[model samples]
Target: MMNRFICIPLCLFLLSVCNPKKNERPNGWYYITDRVEDSISLEPIVTINDFEEIKLDSAENLKGKFIYQITGHVAADCVEKWADATEHSIGKRIGFVFQDEVICTPCINCRIETGSFAISAQDTDIKSIYWQIVRKIHSR
Candidate 1:
């Protein structure tokens, strides 16, 4: 079952905390700001950059398939689109880009009121971007 998100400010926390296996993150992951663009307009919106790296944890939740988890300080505005399924929610999708490349265009699933989420790719295309995040982590 999915959990409902409750917002609290002033705390730098993650909803789900799972360390990467052996503390080793694979290639192509990245760290980015939550300031997302409207999927349609592509206009920028000021958003929270409170989160950290997104990693592939386990496949159990995904029918034994691997998926990337975006865990860290989630921002309220980042997930507002998934809070309800109203007219605004209708036909709404969350678009993510890494250095001008599209990461995901997932349909609004649920409110990420907490500060963590996972992205499951229909194809292995995300593998390419995973290394970008790995490089970002290593450079730090």
Candidate 2:
């Protein structure tokens, strides 16, 4: 009986130390901003009948000066894009936009069905121009 009690406490302690709960914002709209440095634009150059790899240009790197904004929806029933499909309840929907350009915009829809969520934007060159994420948004 005493051994069983000690084992339970030890297991609980180990679990607590090993795995900690992640932090999540309250159920509401939130803004996430970050600037990607040394990132290249993955725009496609030309249209080819056959499969061709796209090239990227690394001319300008975004320093901390560049600011990007994401309008995030925390609730599940906020907006419905497709019919006959259940909207994501726990995960949030984020729309990305650059603060300076205002006109030029690249919005990506992201979600975490099981694990981490990542968003990447490709240009005409089919190269990845921008990438961001809401890290570890879900738990098992």
Candidate 3:
């Protein structure tokens, strides 16, 4: 009887230890200024804590379409420069990568700025990718 009682508590402890909480930091992509020395180079501009909320949802009136939305405010300090960079970044690939092996690349066509942003890919499953991103980042 005592062994059974101890085993239950032990199992609970194991579960708690195994399922640790996720970090407060979020992992995702952002737009940044393009730099040039002799040649133009695309630089990933990071906005710290840019995402106030991230969510998964189905596209309205678009059957079988899924979207991931990020809502936040843009940097008020660099509006014009940010706008220019965003325009330059169109038709480019969007990514959030820590290393070569770990990354998420989403299709991007429009500018990234303040307010709400949504990402969806016709060639790839963004919902699946989004979940993978959440798991990969939250697991750390």
Candidate 4:
């Protein structure tokens, strides 16, 4: 009977150690401002934690096809940094990376100042990626 009681607590402890807690810090996700051929910058302009909130949703594109949108709200303290990066990156290619893997390299079309950013992708499964990112943002 004593062994059974000890085993129950031991199993619970093992489960807690093995499972990822919701509040745990997530792995690295980066915004790359520079890239050369297949290699991206080792220094990230911003990390996923810079965002206060991140969400995942689907929307219809001009072609009437459904696509995924991952929208983020820059933390107030990081708004200046985010704005400057976007402004300087206009008409230039930038990248989003997760765990050293390139997620997307899109050209910035304009300067964004609203403290919000949206990343939209077509012909890809963004749902999984979005969830991974959203799980990292504490305010999400």
Cα lDDT listed for each candidate: 0.42, 0.29, 0.49, 0.69
Each model's TM-score, in the order given? 0.42, 0.22, 0.37, 0.63
Q: For model 3, where is the 10-residue window of minimal lDDT?
A: 32-41
Per-residue lDDT tens digits for candidate 4, residues 1-140, read 99999999999999999996543223333344444643555556677877777788787879997788787787898888777877888887667666555667777887777767766656556788777777766454
Those runs of model 1 whose alpha carbons end farther than 4 Å from true positions after fitting are 1-39, 44-50, 58-91, 137-140
What is the lDDT, from 0 to 100, of the residue 19 in candidate 4?
Answer: 91
**How large an RMSD does model 3 have?**
11.5
lDDT of 3 by residue, 40-140 (tens): 12344443233334466665546754554433333466445445655666876555533222244554576655544445545555566656555654554
**Candidate 2 lDDT (Cα, whole model)?**
0.29
How are the candidates ranked when ordered by TM-score, highest leading?
4, 1, 3, 2
| Model 3 regions more than 4 Å off | 1-42, 47-52, 60-115
Give the root-mean-square deviation of each candidate in angstroms.
20.3, 16.3, 11.5, 8.3
Instruction: State, as a TM-score between 0 and 1, how close model 1 is to the true structure.
Output: 0.42
Which prediction has more favorable lDDT, 3 or 4? 4
Model 2 over residues 75-132: C-alpha lDDT tens digits? 2332232111112322322322222111222332443332222222333221222221
lDDT of 3 at 113: 59
Look at candidate 1 and tell me the lDDT of residue 95: 48
Query: Candidate 3 — what's its lDDT?
Result: 0.49
lDDT of 1: 0.42
Identify the leading candidate in terms of TM-score. 4
